[model samples]
Target chain A: MAHRALRIIAAALVGGVLSACTTEPATTGTTGKGSSDGKLVLGFAQVGAESGWRTANTKSVREAAEKAGITLKFSDAQQKQENQIKAIRTFIQQKVDVIAFSPVVESGWDTVLKEAKNAGIPVILTDRAVDSQDTSLYRTFLGSDFVKEGQEAGKWLVKEYEGTSEPVNVVELQGTTGSAPANDRKAGFADVIKGDPKFKVVASQTGDFTRAKGKEVMQAFLKSHEDIDVLYAHNDDMALGAIQAIEEAGKKPGVDIKVISVDGIKDAFVAMQEKKINVVVECNPLLGGQLMELAKKVVAGESVPRRVEVKEGVFTQDEAAAALPGRQY
Target chain B: MTPPDDTGVGGRPARAPGARQLTEHRLFWPAAVLAALLLGNVALTHDFLAVRVQNGHLYGSLIDILQFGAPLILVSLGMTLVIATRGIDLSVGSTVAIAGALACEHIATAKDPGSLPTVMSAIALAVGVAAAIGLLNGFLVARLGVQPIVATLVLMVAGRGVAQLITDGQIISVSSSAYKMIGGGYWLTLPFAVLLAAALVAVTSLVTRRTALGMLIESVGGNPVASRLVGIRAAGLLVMVYVVSAVCAAVAGLMISSNVSSADGNNAGLWIELDAILAVVIGGTALTGGRFSLGGTVLGALIIQTLSTTIYTLGVPPETTLVFKALVVIVVCLVQSPAFRARLSRRRRATAPDRAPAAGDVGARQQEVHP
Candidate 1:
């Protein structure tokens, strides 16, 4: 009886492996654009639906691809580097016209990019860049300048409170520790605000770029510090959380604390409209149309700039009211 | 085993009956340690213990600790029972995500998101789904005889994916006042979350102590084969504990999402299971399973929350905050260990022989054999 059971298990395993192998080639065959239609096939590997910004970015990319009449093979990496690398390899095996991806992290893309390069396929980065040390690995990088976004936030704060001698106690709700956005945003904000003695950061802590943690950390901050003038959050989610915390503490958010944050998600706009948040520095996630254009140009052997910067706008309460109607996320 | 009556061991006298009793009380060290930490916070931060009434609600560091610690207390309470059954549910964190996601998604998509009925239905949906996930874990561990860690791990990894699917990878924000009250609002000048946690704790205690359920669970965990031979129905009890744990996690999820008025699938309850496990361990519940303490777990959760708040109050650098937390946790765990305490006392006795023999001296010498 045991021998028969073992035999059955072995047979089932073999059958499953065979079926998996058979299904793969079928998908590649149908999706492959190596036909007389003369349409450009693009393989886009997305870093999974991690946040509202990412979801908007993915939607934009998908819609733009459809509008541009480009055959897009989309793969969701589920926020794993290995999954992203595997998706890229699958794209290479399928021999798409062009490859593009928003890398999950800054490192570990040298080998895969080299593979795509050797295959004579141009690669474009959207939203996030990689640190491969070899510029030839990809055609160009396209994303908002996170540091510049931070500087703009600082500049806005400076302009708002210009000539005020009273010290402005700023408490920062940073993003996930060690992330590129968190590091660059902190550096940029500090760089712009360092010379001004009136602007002092009383407390800074990582909220891990989440609403719950942001609320919890802000609660702690409120309990610890008696006077907090400004709340500088790395992202809108954290700012929203801090708004809740401030409300729970029985204080006005925008009027009392003058909250400032990054990322232009729709919720941030709603908060700004309600006067709960003071300002939002936009880190635009709608790179799909731009990416589509760049991919087409790269696939056609046209030389593009090494780095492409997407234009973004900072929103005050007034701007938020005007933009809330058209907000996508 | 009766060596204490016959002679003293390791140049120490036999423990006094009162001293032995005190030392054997499992909660003694945990309570003392928690008290010490709270006192330390009071000394370090001015107005740390001050409570003020604001908008007919209590606002202070002490109140904040209980309010914020409510989720950890709930999670750890469930963890204590699971640990008592010789099982670990690493998926509580994921269950938290799924529960919050389901509730927030329901409320966000509802026709009248602010309605009490909508909020009630959303909570029910979240709890029901979480219970089903717990049933799966129990089925895998008890029925299929899978390793507890491995079985729960399946959900630990996949549950976040399920949550993301429910929320469609967006942070669903809702404006339901009833739901918000569950997490962020107050009642009678106290946080609703704390009240809910206290009520749950009381119910859990009454059910476990007033019935044979606790004993049966302990029997099963102590020896599964023996429990089966005695017809203790270990499988059913295991399923019940897991379901209870899932429900607890769901309630915690509700509180968390409600506090922020948003449900983030990716970061709602990240690493909360680890914190719950630490709370369980700090509460004097052995991983090997058998005896447990609900009161100790409450104190453990409070200690952790207080430590976090103290980190900010002390102005620790953001980079070294985690390191500082680790150092304090290590110190607390070391101080709680009977063996470690015994060693310290022994070294002190060796250095100064003139010191009077205290209650711990006899207890410390006896602990050498166990160590």
Candidate 2:
């Protein structure tokens, strides 16, 4: 283990120094001199390849940066906070005009963002946000309203079963434990469900936003709850897992236990079209073009908004089926 | 000045039954874990005893526990063998993703709707992809002598990248009936995936125990120098173990994708290596190498799955479950430690001298120390 850590540290240092020595201005900002010749150097620390949405988001940002003539230095954090911290430090040392990242989780980022800020490198949050109360740490956050998405899912549930007298035994398949999405979605959905005493979350567990884990947790839910009327998954993968469990029990998923989830990935749309899933609240992952545009604006000394909300919406079976062919995220 | 053979038996010979005690020594803690998990679950829920079958499948928390545990068990079995050699494969999770992607690719690209041969070919392609990764891991570790963690980690990062590249960041929905059977099929009211796990366990035990392979592995783990001197072919064994582990992860990936009927490159098998490692550790395999227990690993997987199931069943806050599991694992490790047991017995005798150091006093000492 000691040897392995040394290798990792050595590799990281080499990667850092290599990135630092490249003297040419690889990118240009949108405002000052974003011409092809005058590019603004920007570094992006990604949160590893955690999901399909993440991969798409990373590609979008990279492409957007290229299109905007910004020199983009990319680092894959592999889902570790320490690696991300190191990447940010390297970006700062490189004296890039701008730095941005999709944090793996919400906490443990204040210190690094503060460092970047002190170094005069403005940071932009792409997909996920940090928990710091100081809004001045980063320029702006560009992402979905996760809590609103959850509320939308909840509202849809309330409306769907408004006239029914039967009590709805719902089980929630949450994302990673203590993550922003997990906490926000749980809070948002529970806030709405609190008013209806007839609806109860019979069982809830974290699937960690992975298909295998989601399936495992759903299996556990199937065992404990005999009459789960609805499964509210934090993502479509978990919803898909619950669908398997529902089918394995010789029950129809759409008919026996309704599934409402977030993350309108193409597969989720397909599932919706097939009647395996009932609803999904879309969290647009194609935020790259928007993030790059904002990064350029920040570096150009332009006033960007404190928070730029991505255009996101909810999808029902009908809508999902209709949009399956064109769904990008 | 001469080295005594650790593999030497007590009296008759080095291969005698008494030496079996060496491997058997690690079984107690896993059993205790199983007992604790069962008691905890039964205590938490009144209907834990109820069992039912629905839709030609078993419908109980136990089945749910097993269903969840199957993949963990399969992967941990391989992890146990790998860790038994003082090696870790952080790339197993990504290897799983790659396998799933490969399977998805084969199924998605295949034009045959219901052809059995094409489905078989896809399965072969998936398994072959997993084996190739295993071979690569083996090559890096056994040939290049890179640290198992590092070698696997390179793949861990790059493997998922490759999977994403193959899928083009798309979750390929597999419509093949043959591929679906791997995850969604059943046998005698049990999930076929669960059965597959059992089959792997049975086969692993047979191969490891029925031949000299188990002894060779233990020898390599306990004393690589000595094993090499005795012509044990340590490198070949190391490579073989990692390859086997990779194949197991691939099987898990196949099952996972088949269950969902889609291949997600990003989230196919995320952080599962951690669970597999934890299961191996909880099963009494020393991370430092030279010891392993397959049955104990199976018990460990069950304990983990059951604990998670119990947490959800009892409506415990999801965030606290990890803390609880960490505590339980720590306690189990402490209890299994010989040093802890020695200190405990010494304290027990110091506390009360009259009972000839009660054989069953371990639990009492554990509660006293923890509480």
Candidate 3:
């Protein structure tokens, strides 16, 4: 057993050394040409598929990579910090030209990103940003303005419910606890909602951005509050879950309990069509095409914005009903 | 003389052929809890018994409960095996995401979904990938000597990242009719997911009971050094348990993606591991391991699903449901504790004979002998 253990250790050391020696060619001042042009090997470590928006975003990135003629080496961290670290190490071992990652959480990524930086493989933040104070760890961040998205939802809710009779006993369903989206959205919403004394957020809880959890939380909310007028869900799935809970309670959704949610997913539009949801703030997950383009530009030594914000907007029930057929989660 | 009360012997009789004894040995807790919940639901709701057929399938809130319980059941079955070895797999949720992505990505990437062979190959490949991840988890735990929880933790975090990498952080909407049927289609009068879980339970029971592998696992879990000394290849068994656990998670991922007709790796199996763990724990599997109860796990899964559904049906506030679920978990755990069991037994003796509390708690004597 001692001999076997020693052998395993030896093999791991050799493999590690070999990997360290043969790093993917560094992305110099120029991007690679075509597949025949020695395709730029790009390593992308993604956050797990957590929602409809995420799934679409991943597809977009893969398709964009194919279109751009980049060899995409992908890893799914299944929403864990450690899995992502292992993947990044493996990517460094494979020596990919460039690396990109949508961090699972906001923290615990500084060490890995610094390692990639040290290896001369430029890293880009996709969809989500890291929490490091060091800006030089990564090349640039390309994603939606999550805080702004929350602000938009809050702004719309303020205007929509301006002249209501009963104070809007708004219950906020937060995203995954400790996630960037959850924290940012909470900050943005509270920023606006705090100004209005009448607009009281009676309850707030993490639905973890899941339909089941959203439904569970909503059920509890209905039991506690008799006169909840509005539900500000962090995402659409949570809204959908809340809708189910409302229906089960024999209360008409849009009529009795108004819902304002982000993530203009197809299902949310369908809910809008059924008058279950009142409004949806759009977060364009089609950043993959833009991300791929930016990746190429970054590789080409072309100057890019430090933070590229994707063009997205808020949609009311009327807008949602109009775009129900075209809306993509 | 009288077989030395071999039931109390170490290492589960060390190769005994008493499958019936395993099943009949424990009772009450799970069954009684389930029975109590069912009676409460029936008595509380006006139309709890009402069932209807919609689109040629059963339609009711109860159906929803069963439907939601399906994935939990599948994951818990795998968990049962791992927990039986005094090990835990925290990565099943992530494995589900990876598997779901692989399944949907395969169908979406195909130029023609009509190619049955290609689809089959993709499915096979995805299952293979899931198995490989499982193998890695097993290797870490069994060979590298990492704690099972910590070994699987890496996958739990990185597995979803891998899935997202596959789908490129997108929701891969699959239009394949075959894929959709796995989650959306009905089997007989029940959801296909429920049917799949039921089939898995039966097959798992047969495999564990019929083969020496099952007994070997129990013995190893019960006493690792003794089993190793007896030439049971304990490391190999540990590895197998994790691998099987991952495969089960993959199956669940397929069902989920099909039901939604899309694979969103980020959202595919989020927090599902929590549900699976709860199910395994409630099903009467000790958190510290040794004995596994597939039947109990199923009942536990059903109870959890029903509790969630009931909260919705009964008009509980959405935000409080998490607290409620946490509370239910706490209550169940407390009830299972030895101290609670002893207290209840003492209280029972003071009450009337007919009204004595049901034997829902395992005796302290049994735990001491086993531990």
TM-score of each: 0.93, 0.81, 0.64
RMSD of model 2 against the true structure = 6.1
Residue B62, candidate 3: alpha-carbon lDDT: 69
Model 1 chain A: ten consecutive residues of lowest lDDT: A21-30
- Cα displacement (angstroms), candidate 2, residue A203, comes to 1.9
For model 2 the interface RMSD, in Å, equals: 4.7
Q: Which prediction has more favorable lDDT, 1 or 3? A: 1
| Model 2, global lDDT | 0.79
Cα lDDT tens digits for candidate 1, B1-371: 11121221112343355655555566777777778877888888768889999889998888988988999999999998998899999999999999999999999989999889999999999999999988988887777666788778777777887888899988988898889999888998899999999999999988987898877877777778888898888889998899999999999999999888889898888999999999989987778776677887888888898888887777787788889989989998998776787888888888988888764466566676543
**lDDT of all predictions:** 0.86, 0.79, 0.76
Ranking by TM-score: 1, 2, 3
Candidate 1 has an fnat equal to 0.55
- Tens-digit lDDT track for model 1 on A1-329? 66566546544644554333221212222346552367788888888888888999989888888888887888887777888888889889888888889998889999999999999989999889888889999999999899998999999999999988999999999998789899999999999999899999999998889888888889888988999999999999989998988987889999989999999999999999999999999999888889889988998889999989987998999888899999898
Q: Report the candidate with higher TM-score, 2 versus 3.
A: 2
Candidate 3: stretches off by over 4 Å: A1-174, A177-207, A210-233, A237-261, A265-279, A283-312, A316-329, B1-25, B38-50, B114-119, B139-147, B228-236, B287-289, B311-322, B347-371
True contacts kept of 2: 0.55
Better of 1 and 3 by DockQ: 1
Query: Mind giving the per-residue lDDT tens digits that candidate 3 earns over A95-173?
Result: 7777888887787888988889888788888888888999888888988888998898889888987876566788888
